[model samples]
Target: MTRLGDGVRLAVGTLTAVPVPAPRQIDRAVAGVAMALGPFAALPLAAAAGLIVLGGAAIGLPAPAVAALALGAVALGSRGLHLDGLADTADGLGASYDRAKALDVMRRGDSGPTGIATLVLVLLVQFGALTGAISAGHGAAAAVVAVLCGRCVLSLCCAKGVPSARPEGLGATVAQSVPRAVAALVFVVAAGLATLAPGLPWWRGLLAVAVGYAAAALVLARCVQRIGGITGDVLGGCVEAAVAGALLATA
Candidate 1:
């Protein structure tokens, strides 16, 4: 039988996007396809963005609903990766003064009031931006662009100078394994095109890029200073935050 141990190792390596192939190659051919997982991560958000557009068109759904649904899409696509970070960061930041305590709080699986509050705030901001965009009569295209931009921010974050916080967490794995240039190039071209889709002023796109990057940098700086480096959750929060900033700029 194809050994389960070998299978697990292969799967982990692939999901982690590690270039180093394992010696005990599992019969799990699916392992090879794992290489695409990093890029494929963008699809869910894109789908969610589409759904928000549909929601907007069908009844001119209020901004809150569109934002909620759109944020839902981002959550679905990311599988709550960043939300996890947001939760952990909240718990960690809320409980302790030093770095170690903060890290420990975050590492714990249990949620606390801080985590809950953080998630609520993040979702609210996301929804507000979606509402503003829709109200501006941008249609689903704005949602799509925001989703694309968010992913692009994620890719850029992973690709750039920020190092990983944990040795084995998702963020570090991506930072270490993925080809920085290819991933970054794909995200930039895709996001730039998507953000410009609304046919807004050229200045709007530039503004979004500038504002998004600035916000991301500040957040990243905090993550690094607070807990040593960027975590997977930090990456997700950054993406959502960037999208919010982008929508606000466009709005």
Candidate 2:
């Protein structure tokens, strides 16, 4: 039980700007455990973002503005870590098809034309889909579902079959940390919650889950084929892509 609490603390501390203290020990096993618990840590952040969207809507804000606000809240809460990952992954993959070159580009910490383009396109799609959902009176529900799906994909990325692209760093520490069964269980719970999200039709909720899973899977497969395995950036990219896909489905 103490270990579980520590894992949760580690997850929340690392993944978000939430005010949780660091765990007493930081090791591979602890990091792996934290990755498995990531979905739970994301719940409060998602709820906060959902409330922001709903509140903005209640004040008669435009759908696009409200969606942007919600996105801003999420980025602030997570310190834009995921967004950074997304941009790096895009730049690396787009700069070259060569695996080593791609990895090198990703390590440079600077956005290239392809990275900038990818970020712009993805953010636009996310904003557009969120605006559509809000216009349809599903802003809060869509926010929650999208955020949950995004975090859930992290578990999938860490599943036992997934390998790390590098020998060191976060990607390797969390690589294969989550058992396939655990990933499946997280997905089942996420899907069930999606079905219960307020203002979403059951069919649409299911579709959101399906789209999120497919997007994550596609990204994972491509990363594995291109880079030989997953990286921290790849995981981040998967989360954003899954969120966009889920929100689009809801819309």
Candidate 3:
């Protein structure tokens, strides 16, 4: 029980900017819990996003602007970790067919053309889909669902058998850490939660969850093909893609 408690704290600390105390001990068991609990740990972020959408709509802000602001808030909440990861992953994938060169490109701080282009395309898609959801009065629910789905996909990415591309960093700590059963359970829970979100039918919720899972899987498969395994950047990219897919389905 203590280990599980510590694991929860670790998940919150890692997944958010929340200043929780460090875990007393860290191991594969703890890492698995942390990744598996990512979606629940993201509850605060999800609530903030939903509230932002609700408040923005109430104040008559344009849906597009409202969604942009909410997404900005989401990015800030996570310290822009996943967004940067997405860009880096894209740059890495597009950099070179050679694995070492691709990984080297991703390690650099600067955004290259591929990174810039990917970010633009993803941000535009997220913005457009979110804008539609807001205009349809499902903004808050959609926002919450999208955020949860994003984090939920992280568990799947880290589930057992998903190898880490590199031997170190965040990827090394978390890669293949989660039990496949746990990952599946987390995703199922996310889908169930989505079903209860207002203004979204159970069918749509299921569809959104399915699409999110599919998107994450595709990203993972590509990462494995390109770099031999998953990495922190790839996991981050998966989160963004999952969120975009979930929002699109919701809209």
Candidate 4:
């Protein structure tokens, strides 16, 4: 639990220019904590809840506007973990040949052409899905459910057995600390609760999980093969891709 607090500090540090503490220090300190409840995944779920509560007022707004606001809240809250991951993963995968080079590319902290293309494509897909869902009268429930369940996928990915490319990297800590069973429980419970809301069918929410899992398996498998295993950035990418995929599927 305390580690989660440390993870929170790390997350806060990443988002803001504020220097609270060393990220690697906080990362190590929060290893157990992050394992317990999920890290960046938790924040997006929280943001989704806020979006759901605000949906009544948001309903009148354009789908893109509402989605932008909600995504803005998530980006602000988590400090762009997913976006950065999305970028890094794109750059690395596009530029690298094998595990070592991919991991090296990801560590460069600079976006490449692939990263730019990925960012643009995902944004278009996300906004388009949001617009379609809202137009179809499912945005409020679908987006909320997708966000939470996407985090469920994040937790699940952390729990899976995958070798880290580098012994000292973020993936190593997460892979070692997170228990698959605990992560599974988080996914099941969160998805169940999110489904219990008034406007949505429970089956639809469960379907979102199915969609997420399928996507995660495919993406993470490639990630593991290409980079030797997952990292904080990959985890962030997983959440974003899963959530967006779920929203589009459920829509």
lDDT of 3 by residue, 69-175 (tens): 99999999998988899999999999899999999988885789999899889989899999999998898988899898999998899999999899987888888
What is candidate 3's local distance difference test score? 0.90
Q: Which candidate order results from sorting by lDDT in descending order? A: 3, 2, 4, 1
Instruction: Flag regions of model 4 displaced more than 4 Å.
Output: 1-32, 39-45, 48-59
Off by over 4 Å in 2: none
Number of the predicted model whose lDDT against the real structure is largest: 3
Which is better, 1 or 4, measured by lDDT?
4
lDDT of each: 0.61, 0.87, 0.90, 0.68
Candidate 1 displacement at residue 147 in angstroms = 1.6
Question: Model 3, stretches more than 4 Å misplaced?
Answer: none
Question: lDDT for model 1, on a 0 to 1 scale?
Answer: 0.61
TM-scores for the candidates: 0.73, 0.96, 0.97, 0.82
Cα lDDT of model 1 by residue, 1-251, tens digit:
34544434543343232344473753323222222233344554666676766766687666667767776766755567656766776677677778777777777867799888977886676677667767777646666666656555655556546677777665565543334674556556654665466555656666665566666667767877887776666776676677667676766
Tally clashing residue pairs in candidate 4: 1
Across residues 58-127, which tens digit of lDDT does each residue of candidate 2 receive? 8899888899999988988899888889899989888888989998898887988888888889889999
* Ranking of candidates on TM-score, top first: 3, 2, 4, 1
TM-score of model number 3: 0.97
Worst 10 residues of 3 by lDDT: 102-111
